[model samples]
Target: MDKLKPFPAVPSDGKIETIPFLKACRSVVKLLETFGPVLMPAVDDIHGNVKKLEKIYMENQTEFKYLNGMLLEEKRKMGCHARIALLWLRRGLELFFVLFSKVVEQHAAGKVLQDLRPLIKQAYEETLEKFHGYRTKQMCMGLMEKFRKYKDFLQIMGANDERSESSVFTILPVYLDGIKCSTEAIYNRMVKKNQVEKHIDDAETEKTLTQRELDKIKVEELQMLQTEEKKASQDQCI
Candidate 1:
């Protein structure tokens, strides 16, 4: 049998050549191997001339911006909602530090039965209203959930007197750090979502208006009326 001809070798960085179906299939497979993972998610999101996830992300950002600005102003004005939020966060931090100190004391000075009645009572009272306020506002639900977890931990550890050197006092700081990070993330996301939505809405409105068409119509009508008036005036003069 005669030897089959070798396919032409295309340059590595050049445009792909049009070829027979089988060869094209091989080229597509090679391209997929090269870039599938990098391109798949983007293409999937952009399928059928729709970018649903992108639109959702943009709208959320727009709504978030407006909410964030309003919240900031409310905080500045010492609004009840803002006050409650600040108090809730501050109380959480204070509780963590106080509990941590108590753990340290139990380890070092052998003071295990020291009363934390007043501090815990105060934290509960101050934060109860704030928690309720957050629930009402529909803000900080995620923070509240994390706060509940910390509260449960504190309750479980509240009565324990024996403190091992390897106890998880460090975890208190980690919990507080997580709360701070989550709160900040929520705030930033809300602000960005609000801003993006507002911009999208404004763009859509502007797109629907045709200023050039309206102006041209008005000018043409005025010119036609002016021409009739000029002819009438000439007739009267004659």
Candidate 2:
């Protein structure tokens, strides 16, 4: 019989290169940061429009009561005259337009907010998944290292001892559990860091409304208020 050729020895110094998923993750994170601020104005604008509509609706309700009171007093004094017709026409149009405008504005705002919701959720999930993926890769690398070391130790301990196999079987589960625990801890830390970073970013951006933008919003609001007041006063006069 031919002599059995010895198998080539495995290189002990072989190095495995880890996947660079973290670099891709960092790029995604940077993208999220850049686009996140761009979306904020749209969000804030929608919110402001909603609040403005609500305020206008409430004001219209109050004005409706006042108009009704005025109409009642006019009817009592005038005693069934055509002046009531003009009064109702003017006041009624004002109230109708106010309600109509509020409805229209609110509808528009709701549509914009709805469109943004999906984008926000996607960005959040992408960041979360990337973080999880990085942690998993790290844990896998650590487990592989432990596996290599354990195998080497077992080889050095020799093949005849049944106790070594038994010990390995018992300890393997613990090693796996430790890796799992480590992954969980890393995942939790990443999540906490994301949350804290988000909080800080939100806080910093909260006061980022530019003076020009704020002034423009204020002017538009004042113009609307003035227009409404003028219309109401004109109705009361006639």
Candidate 3:
């Protein structure tokens, strides 16, 4: 626990170094390992997604040096897996941050671990609830029922003492900021690159789409039509 380092602040250029960011995530996984069976799923998700990003970095260390660069390169190559991994990884980090921030809030208010179980549930609702299917959400709630005892839990996380608590309290805010900044930087880049996939609702779909969205939809529809026409022309010769 003492060796666990908080993620470094985003660099001056706002480019998160891939290796360093992944190293910080490794620390996140190490800490979550303290939660036993309750967080094993999250542990697995983080480990898996980290590997996805790490694989790309290993394949092209220089080109994939920064997170945004990796996203752009992968997206340019139509390699969507790394981008998807990033989406889930960001969500998992968000969940971890929310849960720990809530715990810190409760602790500051003189609350103990017994009082934190519901807070943990609330954190899930705030972070990962929307993304999780009904069954997975239920499984998460069920696992909450087996949460460990207060002192035992604290001991595992090294939060039992004033010094350790202070360490977390001091580090949590900056860590949260780092995650938000880095993820946001990459997400914005994806959107600018037209790599973000989102559904736009129109009166046709019984949903409302903005003017920009309406134009974007028309462009995509035209592109699809062109593709089909090209394919039909090729089939005629065969």
Find the candidate with the highest lDDT and give its number: 3
Please provide, for model 2 over 1-238, each residue's C-alpha lDDT reduced to its tens digit, 9 standing for 90 to 100: 0111111221222111111211222222232233334333222322333333333335445432322332234333332111212222222222222322332343345532223333333433333223234554344233323222223333432423667645544443433343233223323322231122222222124346466754544454445446766888999999
Return whichever of 1 and 2 wins on TM-score.
Answer: 1
Give the Å error, residue 221, model 1.
54
Q: Candidates 2 and 3: which is better by lDDT?
A: 3
> lDDT of each model, Cα atoms only?
0.33, 0.31, 0.67
Looking at model 1, residue 4 earns an lDDT score of: 14
lDDT of 3 by residue, 92-198 (tens): 77777787777667777886566457866787788666766677778889987776766665677677888886776676666667767766665665432343334
For residue 227, model 2's alpha carbon misses the true position, in angstroms, by 38
Model 3 misplacement above 4 A = 190-238
Minimum summed lDDT over a 10-residue window in model 1 is located at 1-10
The list of candidate 1 runs beyond 4 A from truth reads 1-70, 73-80, 108-110, 114-165, 173-238
* Off by more than 4 A, model 2: 1-160, 191-238
Candidate 1 lDDT: 0.33
Write candidate 1's Cα lDDT for 1-238 as tens digits. Answer: 0111122332322211222211322332232223223222112212311222223324445432322333444333332232223223333333333444444445456554434444333343343323334343233223233232323333444424325223445444443344344333333433232222222122123235466643443454345446756888999999
Please, what is the TM-score per model?
0.25, 0.18, 0.74
